[model samples]
Target: MSIQDYPSRLSDPKSRKTETFSYLPSMTDEQIKAQVQYIINKGWNPAIEHSEPENAFSYYWYMWKLPMFGETNADTVLAEVQNCIKANPSNHVRLIGYDNFAQSQGANMLIKRGDM
Candidate 1:
């Protein structure tokens, strides 16, 4: 996958918060997502899809920046996603926008990422 496809897969700007990565110097979107997915794969499920909008960022925050290389938080979840991407970078690196209600290949990437 090309570098251009990285951001959208890493985040849905229309709904996901952008500010979390603003201060994380040097991390590409791909790396950030690898971090998040690895976290998810480890079993630390963040507060997913909460009803109150304000609480949403908490989930986003967890997904966006947990699991850095030397982080105290790094563990199985981050390792799993990192391994998947390392195993197949081209397959895991692309994103096609799709909401949960819609069914399509775009959603498959998340499934493939173990994010869904």
Candidate 2:
């Protein structure tokens, strides 16, 4: 197949595309917990954000309250993720680990997919 033919296999343009992980199979809860643990171990602050499916690829996302600074408990971060999901059932929810030292995002992953 030619490179030009690749576009034909892609989903519709209007369809939702969250992030790199979206292309992979949906992650289980345990896997998500492990990721959260990894983020905490990296000394990154965890934050929850959500956006409409159409804006999934956009640079900005609505922050769920604020980032949990100095939060070491994985369960606490996971709970906030659930809260964001419940509040925005029709929007895509994501978890991001902000690196204060680097002043940028160190980790990002889609936790839930909204209705497309």
Among these predicted structures, which one has the highest lDDT? 2
Clashes of each: 5, 0
Q: Please give, for residues 20-114, the per-residue lDDT of candidate 1 as tens digits.
A: 34323545556656655554444433211111223333433123223233233434434554554555443312222222233322221232221
**Cα lDDT for residue 5, candidate 2:** 23
Q: Of the candidates shown, which would achieve the greatest TM-score relative to the real structure?
A: 2
Encode model 2's per-residue lDDT on 1-116: one tens digit a residue.
65432232236744445567877788999999999999999999999989987777678899999899999999999989988888899988889999999999999999898887
Looking at model 1, which ten-residue stretch has the lowest summed lDDT?
107-116
Q: What's model 1's lDDT at 97?
A: 25
Off by over 4 Å in 1: 1-73, 93-116
lDDT of 1 at 43: 40
**Regions more than 4 Å wrong, model 2:** 1-16
Native-vs-model 2 lDDT?
0.86
lDDT value for model 1: 0.35
Error of 1 at 47 (Å): 13
